[model samples]
Structure formats: C-alpha cells, structure tokens
Target: MGCILGRHDSFVYPTWHSDPLSWSSPLDSRRGPLPLSPSPQRGEGERHTRRRAPSPEGRGGQGVRTTRARRDGFTRKVLAWYARAGRDLPWRRTRDPYRVLVSEFMLQQTQVSRVQEYYPRFLARFPDLDALASARPRAVREAWDGLGYYARASNLHALARVVSRDSDGTLPAEPEELIKLPGIGPYTAGAVASFAYEKPVPAVDTNVARVLRRVFFGKRETRNGKREVWQLAAVLVPRNGKRAWKFNQAIMELGALICVARKPKCPGCPVRPVCRTGQSPVS
Candidate 1:
C-alpha cells in the first residue's frame, strides 16, 4: 500500500461485546439447580494457543491470528530496540497522567524536540488537572503559543474542567472513558490509555500508520485503509499489560526516528527482518 494518510472522524470501538447476563439468564432461571458439566480438558496445542493468545492485541478475535503473530514479533523487536535506542523524553520519565496527557496534546502537530522545551514550562504553570482547570483559557492558550493547533490547547483546557468536575480530578484509565473527555479522540485516547494507564490499546498516528502500511501490508492499497491501519495497530499491542507502555512508545519512536516518511532508515531498523519492504533505502 502506498500509505494513504489523512485525518478522519474518530470512532470509538466498544470494549465489552458479550453480556454476561445474556449468557447466564436462561440457565439461572431454571427452577431446580442445574448440574454443572465438568470443563473439557484441552489438548497440548489448544493449551499453548490459549496461553499465547493475548498478542499485543488484547484477546485474540476472529481473523486476527496472523495479525497477532506479526504484531507480537514486531512489538518485541521494536521494544528491544527502544530499550537501547529510545530518546530520553520528559514524559517517559514520569507516570503522571497529566504530564502524559500534555505531551500527547503537544505532540499532535508538533515535534518532540519542540514539545520538550515547552512541556516543563507548561507543566510548571499548570502542574495538575486542578491547575489547568482553574486557569483562564487565555492563559493556557498563551502558554501554548508556537504550538499551532489552537484547538488542542482549547480542548485540553476544556478537558481539564471536565475531568476536574465530572471525573473528580482523575483522568479515566480506560480508552473509552478517556475519549469522552474534551479534545481526546481515538488516537489520543489510545495513546493515553497505553502510555499513561498501561492499557494495551494501539495509538496509530501518521508515523505509525506509515510504518504499519510499509511493514505489514507492503505496497498493496485498500479501501478504508486508515481504519484497517488502526485495526492492525489494535491487534499488535502486547498481551502482557505491563509492556503496553514500552510497546506503544517503541512504535512511536520507530516511526519518528527510523521510519521517516522521507528516507526511512530501514537498514538500521530492528524489525527489518520481519519487514516485507526489506532494508532498501527509501527512494
């Protein structure tokens, strides 16, 4: 696929699909106590599959087996690479949700180096959700000067109020809940969930979208490509929740540093072995 990247209206996928009540209703309504059947023992292969089922994606879903394997391999390679090569970012050093949220907002249309200088100052002024919520919108906008996306800053200020009043000054840990906040959409929700709360959700940005298109789908183009790109990203998150942060960061770092839109350094990429595009330099 020739990497078709564009902004689209963000859609949130429901987290819980199966209702336990629906499954238990009829069985529980029986007058007499129902005899419970012993659970069948799975064969060795089945056991192995069950054990390894949680790919970078949460639980294995239909048509996701191959996607999970590729993502797992890619995640491991990228995280390993990140451990040695990842940049010393300010947000990486903190576990605070507010800081992570700020960095993510700044990073929407701005570069990391540029965000770095402003991040500390911004945080220094509006150190917490309460601080941001209480500050004037103009002050926040003024502080966000040079970062062109005025809407993001505006939304961030609005979100602070929402979180402060509605959420009781705590940002929700779930991606679904985060998306309900002002200025937070699919990508930002996923990024905050994975990066801040250690939830295994995929945050696919332009760089991530390009890296995925090139590495997995090769050069074949498809309709609704961006949605497919996000689906691929969601499946690749590591099952081990603790590694979700590292995994998400590694991919973003790879896209930012190695998988440059122009002149990608494929030869030096750790996941090059699995990359279908091979190690050829970008034309």
Candidate 2:
C-alpha cells in the first residue's frame, strides 16, 4: 500500500480474539500505579453489526454534522478494540510526561520492539526530566547509543534542558509550548499534548494517518494526501478531551495492528463498519 511507510515487530499483531496482552517492558514498580483509564464499551467480535458512516463531502455545516456522528461511531469501535486487544507496551502504562517524551522520541520511525528494551534502562539512568537535563551531552548520547537516530537523542537531550529549565523541570502540556523545544515538531508536540496531557489534539503519525487514509478515502494518499490526512486528523479528534487521549491511542493501535499497511486483516477489523475501504478487501 502507498501509505505503508514502515512496519516493525515492536507492536503486537493479535491473531486470536482472546490473546493476552503481549508487549514487553522492563519492570519499574517504583513508578507507582498508572492512572485509571476511562472504560470504552466492549464490542463482542462479529456480533457487532455494520452502521452508516459519514461521506467524504468536504467543508459544509451539514456535512460536518453528519461527520460528527460518523467519527463518534468510529471512536466507539476502535476504543472497544483497544480495550479488548491493544498492545500492552511499557510506555503505555505510565502517564509521566518524561516517560511519554522519551518513548515518543524513540518511536519516531523506529520499531516498538527495540524501544521496549531501551526505555527502562534509559529511565533507570535518567529517571526524570531533571536527571536527563542535568546530564552531559556525551553521557546522554551514550545512553541513547543503540536507538540509531542520534539526532533524536541530541534533540531529546536539548529538549530536556530547555523544558527542565523553563518549566520547573516539567514538560509543557500545550502543543504550542512543546513545539518551541528542540526536536519537538507538530507530531511530537501533538503526541505529548494528547498522550501526556490527554488533550484532544491529532497525533497523526504514520500509523494513525495510514488508518485514516484507508477508512475515509479508501486508498493510499498521493501528492497532497499526507497533508490532507493531517487536516482530517485534526477534524476527526473528539471534542471531549476526556475521550481524546484514549481516542488517539485507539486509532494508532488500530493502525499498527489490524488496519496495517500490507495484508491488513480487514475481516477482523473493528472499524469495518465505518471504513469505506474495509467494505471490500483492504488491498
């Protein structure tokens, strides 16, 4: 598929409905219990029926209204899948902004499997923003040695210093504030804002955008496809910030596992009802 940028073994590919959560992470019980997640309504396999969805008619008041219903239905299906089948990655278990930041940086065009091994070790060495910020550049780079993108490491370190200095050693929750930091572009900034702060902003990474392309437009985007994808992403996010965080996670996880780039499991996909392409084979 045209939208298939990269697919690594870091994410779980659920083959069975009853499969247990199977993403790896190092133990760090000292971080305390994670915050309770809002429960999404559970969908029981093929028992769920198809529903009417929004059309691709662009930019009108009535069109926007119809789209809202479609997005809500889409959100429910994806979140139910998330609740039932989402990967249990280490970074997902914590709400700490620093941990989220570190994970997001490592995950940029990188595989999840490689990142799971490095995340805790990196955290053990530099437990908080203060620790990362205060460390020497070489030491930080050394810690990030295997992650490949040395520039991300450098920028992450730089961001740590800036955020550590500017905001009482805590990363900012606002996308606007986050973008000013080194290496924190729109995607990273939206990620932090949504994943860390639970803001209802679009975190349109490759995975999320890929899902949107197939579900709404029914094929891989071309030319201005990527740009249009981001705009749609911003529009699709739920207005309720309460659901926003889970919404972002659900879509991304859906893309990563089920609605994947190549050989997508359209038959088992949760959003099949609303997906225009999922109506037929996802090829």
Largest TM-score belongs to which candidate? 1
Tens digit of per-residue lDDT, candidate 2, span 94-205: 7789999998888876777888889999999999999998999899989999878587777778777776776789887766556556766556767788888887766766
**lDDT per residue (tens digit) for residues 1-283 in model 1:** 2222222123323221122111111111012222222112223133121121133232223222245466668877988899999888789888789999998888766666678889999999999999999999789999999877677787788778878887789998865456556666557777788778887667766677878877876666664455456666666767667787888778877877888777778778898988866545566
Cα lDDT for residue 109, candidate 1 = 61
Clashing pairs in 1: 1-218, 1-219, 1-220, 56-236, 56-237, 56-238, 57-237
Per-model TM-score, in order, reads 0.77, 0.75
- In candidate 2, position 237 carries an lDDT of 74
Deviating ranges (above 4 Å) for candidate 1 = 1-70, 279-281
Which stretch of 10 consecutive residues in model 1 shows the poorest summed lDDT?
A: 20-29
TM-score of 1: 0.77
